[model samples]
Target: HREAHAMQKDWMRQSGIEEEEKAPSIDNFEKIAAERVHLGLLVNELVLSRELKLDDEKVKTKLAEVTNAYPNGDEIRKMYEQNSELMDQLKSTVMEDQVVEWLTERSSFNEKEIEFKELINNNQ
Candidate 1:
């Protein structure tokens, strides 16, 4: 932050905007944080309400499938170490998908395959 401020000061001096007053504060940091927490809780509840279960065996199998993409064992281990928390998050996501799959498996949910180009065009 100190370096960023220093660089900003230099830029301001160069641009002859040093005398300009600081921008007004929105002062909604807490509100934004609360909203983010609320969104996270909402998503988690959605996953949980679906009764998603992620067993250790499933996690291992998924990991094995993922590791297949990384030919180097050390690279895979390094990636896992660097993103252990992300791994847990992915596991949770897998559990949620399992719930979705389970529901769709029991009850038929009519799904149609659209061409990739058509789907993108429609989204845009």
Candidate 2:
């Protein structure tokens, strides 16, 4: 579906309808991949060190949050519920969020709003 969306957008762009997208470079992709790996390691370490556990309800909640955007959301959700691989992936993602929340709760940081440009610049 993502590939299909991109193909549609590309055709629109060629037709002079859609605006050019600002996708980052492969170098940025590598950086982001590394950062994700580091985060996954940190989450795992904390999970083991703090003895944190995943809640089944969180996975269900995450699934609902994920599927609610689609047209046939309820149907997709039901299908996902019956798929072991998708359920396992969702469970892992929920655990990652739970671990991040645990870290955030114990840490101190100032909250400030920034522009979209600034956010993208910072990421780059």
Instruction: State which candidate has the highest lDDT.
Output: 2
TM-score of 1: 0.44
Clashing pairs in 1: none
Regions of model 2 farther than 4 Å from truth = 1-28, 110-124
Worst 10 residues of 1 by lDDT: 20-29
If scored against the real structure, what TM-score would every candidate get?
Answer: 0.44, 0.60
Which residue pairs in model 2 clash with each other? none
Candidate 1 scores a C-alpha RMSD against the true structure in Å of: 10.8
Please give, for residues 11-56, the per-residue lDDT of candidate 1 as tens digits: 5677777553552222323455566567657657856786655777
For each of the candidates, give the backbone clash count: 0, 0
Model 1 misplacement above 4 A = 1-43, 81-83, 109-124
